[model samples]
Target: MEKFKTLGGSEGSTFFFSVERQKKWERLDGPIGAFVRVMPWRHFGRKNLGYLFAILHGADFFFDFDDDNYIKVDESTGKPVEILPSTTVLDNVMVAMSGPTAFNHHPMMKPSIPAPSWARGFPWEYIKDEATEGEPAFSQSIPFVSKLNSIGVIHEGATNVLVPKHAYSPYNAQASIHTQPALWATLLPTTVPGRVSDIWRSYFAQCIFADSNLRLVFSPPKIEQIRNDHDILADFAAENDLYTKSGKLIDFLSSWDSEHLHFPQRVEQLWIDLYERSYIELDDVVALQKWLEALITMGYKFPELKPRFRNVALMGQFNFADFPNSMTQIMMWSQKMRERFQTTIAAAPLNKTQLAYLETHRIDAIPARDLKLRKRDHLGFYNPLSNLMRTLLRFENSSTIEAVLYAHDDALLNLTELSEGKYPFPTDKIANRIKGELSNAAFVDLRTMPDRAKARTLSHRVFPNGTISDIDKTIFVNTSSELKKQIPSLHAKYKQWGHYYCAPGQQQMAMDPEFAMYLDPDGSAWFPFHTQSDFLIVPTKYAKPFTEAATMHLKHFIWIECAFGKIVDILQQQLQAPTRLVKLCTGFGDRRGRWDVINNHDCQSESVAVFHPFKIRGRFDEFWAHADEINFPAYSSRGKN
Candidate 1:
């Protein structure tokens, strides 16, 4: 510990002892304490003690050692001994690092000592090939080297270094140095027992390292293991999965096409693919995502060795004065530049113009002080629009609306139906009764058009003689999917016709052809001008493609609200048309009073009498008795009949 602290110096090593961790670490306040608090494995007990410590400290190089491992000593002098000779060559080779290389199973006690034993996690299949009967001899011939990278492998006085097309591993964690590039590979699957975690992680790391063209050197053993107390049977049981599935897992991973994906994305995809193949359970993928998130949160950028351009420029010497002062000239010049330079030039030190360009383009490079001010200014503009949209989209039955409109009432009245005098308001009867009254009106029941045949039949009524001028006024009621397909054609023909639509709520209105007209429903009197009694006049010229797009797929409420609101803006801004509000019956059959507050409003007074006595399952008996007192104006009184 003292030597490590000295070696680390100002970098400061951290020690996480298993016993009384929280009590001991609680005293470490501020950044270090906060770091410990958020560690994913803080509550994992001692299952991942070293990994947790490594992540918390943001270690660049981590040397993992078991408690049972120690430095080898000379038996004659009883002094610590060095394993590797000074003559050992250090370099990387691809062929030597390849997948089929046999595992080194020589006993750690001494290279000259013969042993039949294999390492604990080593696969049983490789025991005969890798194990030797006598001391391992050194090769006198120098190994071939490639120019790719320096990766040296020393085992029993022999060294071979060659870059390989593929790599495999039975690497142990007892004494291993994990470099920064391979830190993501050290994430052990928490679902697996502790015994196999290191072995699996090693295999995963080898894959990652091989993909990155990084070296994995196997040197002579540096540390000797003083065997710890453990049940060999229990250890074997824990390692059972690896023995059975390690080769299969490796083969599965090797078959995947991960060359195009970024390193982090590749790692994440690997886990997901493994889960899909049922190699590892879903819990393993979840753990991988958590680890990846933690790695990103810790600000570790996945290292990409390939160099990339930091900036782009147009390098050719050309005179801008040669072209005419027109958009065509500018476009032509840009095209020629693109064709000549292929859109990018090698990055060089920034010149004055490049620096100025960067200053203008780098919006995200704002300083912290300016960022706060920008956010404050941004909210100043954003909040009011957000609040206004929220208020406009709020349903009539919303508690917030009821709270404001009926604040004085101890118990808010739940208006159940459209009412008149002490007689049951026969809304369905009035529509038939006023057929003579609405002689000039054309009523198209959009709801009845459930199929294209019915939709085409209704279309002829709305657009008589295949032209809009043939109709004086058209009313589309209860819009549905069949009606939606006919709207675009109807709207295209009826450029001047006064089209009106009525529905219960915004969701229903959203399906209608006039949704965009309700943006500033209360503020702009333009909306009310299109109103005739209960129906809101649809300006077919201004109606957007509402039902055409699948808006129900928008899962979040705010998104739907914002999207509809944006549609309203586009209509108002692009079409420059007026929108109006009108009284319409939305809750006809809502007998349970679910839509009572929305339906039973004073606004119902402005509804067209021709479509009065709105039938709602004949449920609002109380409302019908007091219907006349509700002050519903006759269509004739509004001068629209």
Candidate 2:
């Protein structure tokens, strides 16, 4: 440890001892701490760990050496020397890895030895002379060539090197240096005895690496293993499963189409496929899931684990006194160093253009008044338009109207009102009303009307110009049915018009042929529109057309919905256009005028809204509730619609 510390001098090297005093270990603020928190220490003992730790610590490569192993020394000089393969041998192995082929021959094999020898997990079927020796089988090299040093290349030969495409079994965990490409190679199936875990993991990793067109090199042994105090029988028992099923497992993994899946997903699917093929039990699947989840939670972004280490050159030397003895003090010093370095970086002056760009794109600087205006415009247009349409289409008079409203009763009334309305609008009353009055109605819920309308509003925001012409225009129709029919036609007529249509009750808009059709006509695209109200249209230039924006918005909405409003506001500011709220309908209950009443009602019922989803009773009751109080900020009575 002292030698390593000296050699790594101020290079940000960290060591974790397998001591009981884990709490005493400081330096938990960065990625290293995050990794230690999620490590499966209970399952794999400290002796067989650190692959994940290396990744978290941003190591370019990690060297694994067993305690039982020692570096070989020259008798004359008493100096250590790595036992590397000859150039000829490495060249032969290289030929094999260059093609789609698997080699069962061990690098330790000797031609002169008249006895048969095999690596621990080498398949018995390929143990014969022809399979083990002679001309090396070949396959096409990976189409994508990495810079010589960029990829995880294995160096073991004295003068020659080989990158084997297919990794044979018995790639021992000890005396190996794993680079970033093979970082996803995790020791899974913790229930399996420790003896075979590394072997199986290697096979699984090899299969994955091959899918990514990566090669695993088998080099000459660098260290000699000193025999440890272990019973041969016990070791054999632990390795019994590998002897029986290693080949079968390899074949099973090879069959998977990993080209289409991400590394993590591929790992998951591999375990599932294994279970489906009756190779592993359900418990194995569960264990695999836990391992994969731990990897994800530990912040392992596989296949693209880019090195993000900041190299800080040392100026002054550090003595024992400089390193704090107390863990808390050490942590504080480290944190202060980090903050100081950040401050230094932040203090660097930006050029005028960069400063201007930052100012233009700054979202926090957006005035509260502008945000309120935007919200008001959104609400004013959509609320009345949707309400008028519902009323005119006779949707409110439908037999199923009461039933629909009852289903979304929480959205209509607060908890107190819900409790009271139950007696008057019972199940029978709602059902009868639905069957009689709403039988032929569109059956659109008033609660979701805002979101539905917002979908269209978002479409307009993405493509400001009327679809048929570049000029902005607004046309109002008399009835709800006419508005619905004409909206799609109007969008179709305008070359630049795009429609943001969401299916009734959906949280967001759909990406379908119709959406594409609307986008293709005007080269307009969809942007993510989170609100249900479809009234306000901002004539602004967007970074992308409606189609691209809609696709991006859809993707973003899946991850988080709150960012939608922020993104829209950013676009509004960028376009530098007046955001107009065009009124399409009138005579619906004055939503703008009732802002105070709605705001007061919302504030009082905030708690009920939070707990309503948990207390929902009916099948669609949860969907019917307008939990916007929880989803959005309180409606301010100060904003004018």
Candidate 3:
């Protein structure tokens, strides 16, 4: 039998792509010429092995075939003399195919000379007459176009694509009970109490200051007098742990309702600066209105909560009180990031690129519940959050929801109260894609890989061994009645949870302060393809959108580019070394309403250096130094909301 290495790179490397096979396939039904044959074989009886060969059939074109031995045939008439059984021969030939282009690009040919012993097998053989209507059956042998089946698997001949399972370092963190209801079901309130008279006011108030909504409004002059008398600012300065001090400030500041007292902008700005880490909120209503308008103008709509003229007036003045203290703040930020990222990933297929990263997990567009509710033309408006949430859920439950892709960031604004009860499986067109993947029998779970390798029979039943895909796997973990029901439980338990980093002065740096979603046993569902910047990381979702929008909008381009530069700055700051680089990312916005500096057209190019925080000693140490009672002035509170 003849032997030769297949013409290609290493096995299973999908490099450059082309339409080679389709081009060669133009051969069918045009004319009767020399015929080509392909075959496979079984070695070790069941053990698979084979060799690839080529022979000329029609002039110039090659019939793709391979084997060590040459089988004799009547050359003049192109008739088979003696050879192996067709099935065994076919099997052997199939085993040798490296990829689709292997035969597609080769010159069609015929075998010659005496047959070898290995080629000797039971059964008759002959090349059949060409089909008259369409392409021949051998066309299926081409590869590299279908989805991958397992973690280590790859399409043959592709390069430059990252293999996360093989390339990246592992740094797993358990999902925090504070962030996941499936883990914190026991800790949730049995039922929420009576509703506040003004849910909008309550929600708005909650957004401004975290501890409670009513604290911000003190009507009694006596209470105001006491706030001035007490050494609130001094008390704040006296505290050592900045996190605790910030919490205290948040508790006091969130309770203030300014409509009654009419406190000056300077006072409110103090609290805002300390909590949000920015000083953009000036005293003027027009200034605040301009800022809100700016965000809207930049495509950051306020989603479902359309404001009445009065509501818009209220929102313009509303501030996120101390509740956005770092721990609470970053969690909410992560949630917003999660929502946008998931939507972007799901909506990606609409672009229709040949080599998109989302080919396997294509999802449908979001469904609008209030299709009738276009921007309200009348005087009054409704809260858009509900409609937005419904739309988000509908898209989330869509059948196209690819399990292979998942969000890495935590929730930015988790309103557990809003997330109570079980949510039914969404019944919408989007649900079909997600459901289809979930029902696929070939899905496999890689979460339970054993360090102590054992037989597949007894391992955890999360995913079956030898499974080729994630299409049929258990993708949905939110078993509760409503998606919101999963919120409070997660927040209460995993509020301060995050990925820790060790840097100068800070022994550990907190990347996220909420429970991060992960595969149950411990594995990642998504893979990182590229970074948006030296410090800013962009998974497929952000990467795709940023790339698309950057071409059109200078704002997105500048912001994303600045974010990339900021990432490096952050890394260097954290390491406190010029040599170290920072990793940066966007979770929408911060508590003080600061966007990535790149997005702010008002700021000069140099501001990125200023907005980027310097790495102190360690996470807590730096937090304590920059924050603490010393920096954050305090105010005396009379009571709780």
TM-score-best of 2 and 3: 2
Q: Residue 382 of candidate 3: its Cα lDDT?
A: 17
What is the per-residue lDDT of model 2 for residues 432-543, given as tens digits with 9 covering 90 to 100? 1111222221112222345444334333222323222111224333322344464653323223212222221012322333334334234433333233221111111231
Count of backbone collisions within predicted model 3: 115
Residue 21, model 3: lDDT of 30
Off by more than 4 A, model 1:
1-14, 17-49, 55-58, 73-122, 125-165, 305-641
Residue-level lDDT of model 3, residues 359-434, one tens digit each, is 2212222222232322321111111222222333333333433211111111111111111111111111110001
Q: What's the residue-level lDDT of 131 in candidate 3?
A: 11
Give me the candidate number with maximum TM-score.
2
Give the winner by TM-score: 1 or 3.
Answer: 1
Regions of candidate 2 where Cα sits further than 4 Å from its true position: 1-14, 21-49, 74-93, 97-102, 107-113, 132-134, 137-167, 258-260, 276-301, 304-641
Please report the TM-score between candidate 2 and the true structure: 0.38
Ordered list by TM-score, greatest first: 2, 1, 3
Local lDDT at 119 for model 2: 60
Query: What are the models' TM-scores?
Result: 0.36, 0.38, 0.15
Candidates' lDDT values, in order? 0.37, 0.37, 0.19
Cα lDDT tens digits for candidate 1, 1-641? 23222222234344535446543443444433443343345332133435645655566556666779896788888987654333343433112211132333334223454555655555556556432211222122222232113122222212332222233445656766555666666666655677777677666665555445354554555677889899989988988977877767656644444434466777887777767876566777766766676567556756542211111122211111122322222222222222111121111122344334323321011111223322432222122222222222332233212110100000111112222221211122111111222222223223233454324422322221112211112333333233444454432333222222111122333334443343233221111101111211122222123222213212112122123323433444545534322123333354533334333543244442222333222222222222312322122232211
